[model samples]
Target: MSVFLAIVLLSLNVGRSGGAIKPVVTFTPNWGNILYLDDVTLTCDVPSTAPEEPRTYHWYKDKRPIPGDQQTLHIIESLGRDSGDYQCQTIGGDISDPVFLNVTERYVLLQRLPSLIYEGDPLTLRCHHHRFCKAINPKFYKDDQEIKPSGSDSTFHIPNITRSQSGRYKCTKQIQPCYTPNVQELSDESFISVKELFSPPEIKVPPSRVIEGDEMTVRCDTRLDPLRGGTKLHFAFYKDGWTVRGYDVSDTYRVPSSQLEDSGKYTCEVRTRSDTVRKRSDGLYIQIYELFSSPQIKVPPSRVIEGGEMMVRCDTRRDPLRGGTELHFAFYRDGRTVRGYDVSDTYRVPSSQLEDSGKYTCAVRMTSDTVRKMSDGIYIQIYELFSPLKIKVTPSRVIERDEMTVRCDTRLDPLRGGTELHFAFYRDGRTVRGYDVSDTYRVPSSQLENSGNYTCEVRTRSDTVRKRSDGLYIQIYELFSPPEIKVTPSRVIKGGEMTVRCDTRLDPLRGGTVLHFAFYRDGRTVRGYDVSDTYRVPSSQPEDSGNYTCEVRMRSDSVRKMSDELYIQIHELFSPPEIKVTPSRVIEGDEMTVRCDTRLDPLRGGTELHFAFCRDGRTVRGYNVSDTYRVPSSQLEDSGNYTCEVRTASDTVRKMSDGLYIQIHDYKMQNIIRLGISGFVLSAAVCFIYFHNKW
Candidate 1:
């Protein structure tokens, strides 16, 4: 068959060449396989618009001009020898692209894809058999080598294709359910080409600092080769591996309002007309800032007294991701400036005063931003100072040994309640007690030493305006020893005047001092409150017999001194009392009584008198108002000297008793002699009677 088709092609080409200039030629049914004995036609084209212009065709096989007939149709019969690449030229010098023709008696076919491809692209090939049946497990090869697909598919697909994959490629497939595994059909040869028309997309942002509610624009740009002109491009934006915006034909994108979620790793992708050819850019950091909270003013100690230290601070809440933002602070007092533009938040006052009081506020914001916030107002009030004090003494009339209170009173403003005050006490233009914060000073025990003109000094914080009170006189008295009562004779007869004097031990240290005198008897005042030292009774009487004491004091007496007591006695006349006994010569068997009486004292007028009767200088009878002595029977023992005494109550003025003597005789001895004479006469008669009875 090959020998016969060669002979037929040689006869057709004989004497067909040698045309003028050049023209274009083509075969009808421009693409696809032509089966054996298929009717085909060719046309010779010329660029000249005139129909009368003469034209001719020139044909070539495998890039060599062939001598063919000048007719426009080149026909192929039974196709074995006519299978080749053919090009043609017109007589007017126009050339045409060569087209390939292949004819085979085998029932297998191979399909080819586009020859020109971008670097990042995919390639596909299809193989078919004239039997019109499916084939499984197809294999493809480049330059007679096999192309192994990554997965199980009959058709071959090369993914992410590059320029290195360019070569002649062919594919083969076995008939499905065939008994022999080695039986395969071959496909027609085809060439592949690769061109670098893309670089990685570069992403950029005009403004690096993007906050919430801010508009942002993103650009993904790529370089292109002029040789790949008219290539279509698509763009995509990605965040953290997820697509922020799907691929679109536009290169740059706009975001109206960026949010906190928009902050992350961002990238862009650029693509050619083919979807598989694309470049992704490196990640760009896009951060969205959050707004900062309003500033607040803080005071360390809310309450403070005058002259105390305090601290004020300004603060705010912010997002930590604001990498380069700095916070600045300013303080205001009642709309006036206190501190301006201070980076530090704290302001301090070492000592607060009344003039330093007002409403306070603080303003804070970021240095990079124009917005700032001012805090609410806080108040600081300074109290008026405690000053111009006065002194007061308790118990206006203070006596010796009396406890006293000295108070230093200062004017206080209730608005400033925390004022602290210090005070001191003075006496006789000298400090009596040290300075103390307490306003009251107490004298535990007041003595003569405490007697002086007293004053006080009140102060707050050293009493810048010192004040003193008027002097107060405090008088006291000293205690003296007891007074003495002296009498002229010390003893006085009844009915006579006696001199009595109240004498005190006058202190030599206080010589010639004016003193007051008072006299007391038995704890009762007798002569009271007199300047005279002597307290004399006009006449001394028995009633003057009592205990006497004297008291002495200064003219300005707050307290007095009492004297030891002395007893006084006024007596009667020295004559003895007379005594009398009834029946002075009474016999021994008779009853007797005795009586004695003393002379009554004229000074003791109407005073009840007491008397006693004495025998042999001893009291033997009554000492009562009844001044009589009596015996029931006069016996020999009752015959003795008898006397009586006279005295008043307390036995102060008593008189001695007078003595008397009495005699007595025995009456029974005389009656016994007469009885003996009568008994002798009776004895003579008894002797005569006894002699007569015995005979």
Candidate 2:
């Protein structure tokens, strides 16, 4: 019975677990506060017991059936207007509990912008609004016209706005309702006026007569109401519709040194935080008549005869005449005022004089009280005739060897104009020289000796005037002749000293006068010395062996002349002391000999005799009695050359002969006997010749 009961209970539990209905669902909130207009779903948990066919869903508000019967109910948008209690009911399941939904609105809030504005200024407008539990879009309106739609917080900014931007503004709220319609609300209007602040000041320039490069003042003054609220003001000046000066200042502006360009319609403009205004007074045209242009004068007949009439005109043109203008004209001659005239046009001068023959000018000046205007000067010249005279020679008589000077002088009208007198010198009916000098002439010395039958001639524009002077003769005296250069020991010795002397010859016709002497070498002056007649060069080196010349110049006015060059040769005696020997090697105790000779001039005769000997540097042993020297036996000490010397009181000559070798051998009877007999025979021959010559 227990087994059977267990099987039966297990079967019943299996049957109950096999097929059973359960509920599954998901919910989404669409509306605020009450969660109305939310989405909901209902599903079956058990697969076997779930409905196999289509099923319908019923929407409910607080467990009551809603008007729409559908599985899902959609709300486009949720708002406060659509807030309510909601539920859902399934066809095969129990109804759900009610859900409370609440709606909220969002809006932007705006505030009033600042009121006053100036031209070229920036401004900002704000539009703000609020909605209960909803997000609202804010929009701005100006003068009942929509300006801009701002999201959330509404703000509109304008940069560089003008007065036209001023208007009445308001903020509007936009509402979007869920499952309903949209709504809009407008706030109270805000007043915004861009008020123009101050008008530009009027400018006045005192003493309107403006001149270039003249200092003047321009003042700006006007009536305007002071601005408020930390406003900065600036003033600007305009001329000819263009801005001339602009600066930030409290009010007034002053300008000095109003240039010619500033002489135009001037207006002042004022700028403030709120307004920019300009005001212009009646234009006062400034006439700037500066004395910039120099005066010019015209002259007729620049050159005129000394007793003729001349006319000069001076005039000036300028503007702005305060009173009747009067000009004072003045005429000048050679930097001096010759005459003056007060006239507007030409001034006539009659009967011009010699004093008026120079450069004559006329100047015109306006009255001092009025604007200063001066006319340029006109230069005039008067003509006059004159001739150069008083021709003479300076230091009239010229000496033959002396210098001379000549000069010509003449008188001329100091004011001669257009007439240039030229001085020409004539010699023997021929023009030798000429000068443009109108007053004086000078001739250098020595050149005046060529003057013969001299005359002074002056050339003028019309005619030539000449004046002759008595013929003058020039006498010239010879000063001194050039010095002659003579050398001592004319035949020079090579590497020997020499001396040179210079002698000057003076003319007895002219008194004996000490003259200056100068020595020269190779056509170049070496030194100058003042002496009576002669000069000497004491010592000379090899380089001094050249053609030497001397010059003598008289202390009087005489030209220096150079003498002919003199050449001298210096020779030296032959110096011979070198001596050399050949076959220098010799055996001891052997007979050897040497010869002595030298390259001395044979004309010197035996005085050039040379002797040679063999010795160490200390002493001589063997010497050459004649041209050839012999020695019986040579020793090792005799290995040196045999030296020969020929010398005189002034010179010496020396030479060395070839070395002589000598060797000694062991004594033999035959050698000894032959040597002995040869020596005996040589001795006997020498004695026989000596004795025979004596007999």
Candidate 3:
């Protein structure tokens, strides 16, 4: 028995003269530490204070009895789950306290992070083997070749990784002789891939906001760059968590008529030809709206009287394509907002009064959209039950260049209706034609200034009670006059400034109203056109040379007219610049310079020029305001073809210079001969020393 077990027996015997001996666990070779791929042995021991034969002993791991016979347990190879607290028990003696034993690994393993590490990104490789002891003098290898000398490091790092770094990598861990172990060395290997393209596919839809009955196109916007590798990509389109189409090479999927069911979460999946890589985009939700036309409201009986009932009806000429037949209605009295809200299509006034004598309007709204159509207001007047003092306008819907007439109804009703009434017309609370005993107001041709709310007041020549009619709102459009773009100096240059003005003339005889101006270049509105009449460019570039025009919108009538496109030509000094080297090629001890020529002799008189030189896509000389790049000392390293760039003061219209090849030849014949003679003398002296030693 072990000394620890004997001690436990003595303690139990001393405490109680007739007590049972305690049970304990023991390990073989006097060891308990376990390692991966290592074998270990265990035994259970029990003792009795009495001098009789002892009972049987059993072994338990983690306080649970395992299936086995005898008093010993041997583990051939320790695994991760073998680590636990062990105990032993006898028939009568108390079971032993838990004895903790941990199993660890010693084999080397290669690992990498679970994140994407693309080319040009920092990369790291780790060797996991130093669990029980330190790995001394570790070495890293690539493609079975040593990359560095043996050092005490387990991690290899590359600052800026490139595609060339893709290869099989491995690491070696050396166990120095001083360590007490059978293992001498360990190695781990893994393959690494440096990706160059890792971007996912993007999705788009034509007609961003879709409506029912519209032709729709759902596109997966991914195109291969011709300059890159030739890798075929397969596309898949998905909607509402299910594949709509798959295994296709095209990037777009078309639908003849997009409906409400076509709108849902949409996503696109892009995969490589070999299916080795895949990427999916996030879902995009779409909603399709219905289409509807403007609605109109009808008034019955054509007239209203005080203390009489009347009905107003709102209706849409055609129903919308959107679902559901239910609709909502809203009415406005004077300008707008007669009441909060109403859902009935028919608005009935139980009793007409003078307060309800103003203009009335109605509109119909679909439940799915906030868009609704507003009907032109209809005037309804409330008069005495039998009064005949009435006024109205002929040709109520009058456009520009049209005539309108305002006439008071002179025919009196058969029952006490007023007659012989003087006429007074008021526009927006101001009298236009006073009570001058006239019954008609006529306009030969209406103008934009004639748009206003008009009302008429009439009274019999015998009665003093003046009756007023409901107001009528009219809109008079203005005639459109296209504006023209006027460029100062008529001609523009790339490096020079120019001013652009929008000029138009309205009817000068009757026009003092301000006009809003806007400018356009190639049909797109230019900035600062909303608040300014003229646009100016301090320095123009080649991109600013396009078709330009101006637009004039009438502020009062909201009438817009566009001018003809003007092809603006901006002169360029460097159409196709040329680069030249005077001698082209030279030997050592020759002076050289690269000249940049614009080939525009006529425009070079007052032009401010700048020059630059480049080699191997890198700048050799930059931002030099000169036309010539003189090389101080021409050498063989400067023999590659050089490119030059010539720019003007504007710096936006620069031209590239043709490549100039400069070859430099060596002229060191004498120096070569001197080196040969020196080498021969040194060889002969070494031979003479060897022969002297032999003698």
Which numbered prediction scores highest in lDDT against the true structure? 3
Cα lDDT tens digits for candidate 3, 1-695 = 53333323333322222365555566553334445655667676654433667357677888888866567778777787888888876666567756666566655655453233444445667665645565666778899998866876667878667777889988887653335755478877768887664456787988887765567788887654332234556789999889988958787878766666788888999876556556787888877655444556677767665545767777664334444455677877887666434667877887666677778788766564344557778777765543544557767666555687877654544443534557788778898788857777787877767788888887656443356777777666555455788897576777668788887765544376567788878988775346366888887777888889887776653466678898788776556677787666666667778777665536456666777888766688896777787877777777777788877666755778778677776769647987999999999999999999999
TM-score of each: 0.33, 0.33, 0.29
Better of 2 and 3 by lDDT: 3
lDDT of each: 0.67, 0.52, 0.68
Compose the digit string of candidate 1's lDDT tens values, residues 1-695: 12212222222221223443334344554323454564456555443432565556677877888776464665756376767777777664545555566656554555543123557655556554544344655677789887664234645766678877778877666554244455444455567666776777888886877765457788997876553444578999988899989889888778876666778888999876557676789999888776455667787666644456767888776665654557788899889988887778877877666667888899876574354668899887755455445667776655544577878777765655565666788889889887888888788756667888878875566444345667777664344445778987666666556777887655455467778998877778878888898887765677777788888887877446777888888776433567777776776777776666566546445666677877788778657887677777777777777778876665645676556777655668646766877787789789879988998
Off by over 4 Å in 2: 1-110, 113-122, 130-135, 143-146, 175-182, 187-191, 200-204, 207-215, 219-230, 238-294, 300-314, 317-695
TM-score of 1: 0.33
- How far does residue 417 in candidate 1 sit from its true spot (Å)? 28
- After the best TM-score superposition of candidate 1, give how far the Cα of residue 330 lies from its true spot, in angstroms: 6.3
Consecutive 10-residue window with the lowest summed lDDT within model 1? 5-14
TM-score ranking from best to worst?
Answer: 2, 1, 3
What ranking emerges by lDDT with the best candidate at the front? 3, 1, 2
lDDT of 2 by residue, 1-695 (tens): 22212222222211122343322222232112222232323221222345676666667655567565565566544556655566665565555434455443434434432122444445555553332325466777889898886676556777656567777877776654444466656454556666554444667766666654456666666544333333455667667777777755745444444344556776666665334443354444456555334456666675565545767665455445533445566666666765655554566777554555555455655555233344444445555544325556545545444445445555555565445555666667677676565444444444324645666566543333334445444344445545677776666544345666676555675565667777778877677656634444443344566778877776662567678988765332334444433345445666665545444433333453435455444335433335555557765555543455443333332334444333333445447788999999999999999999999
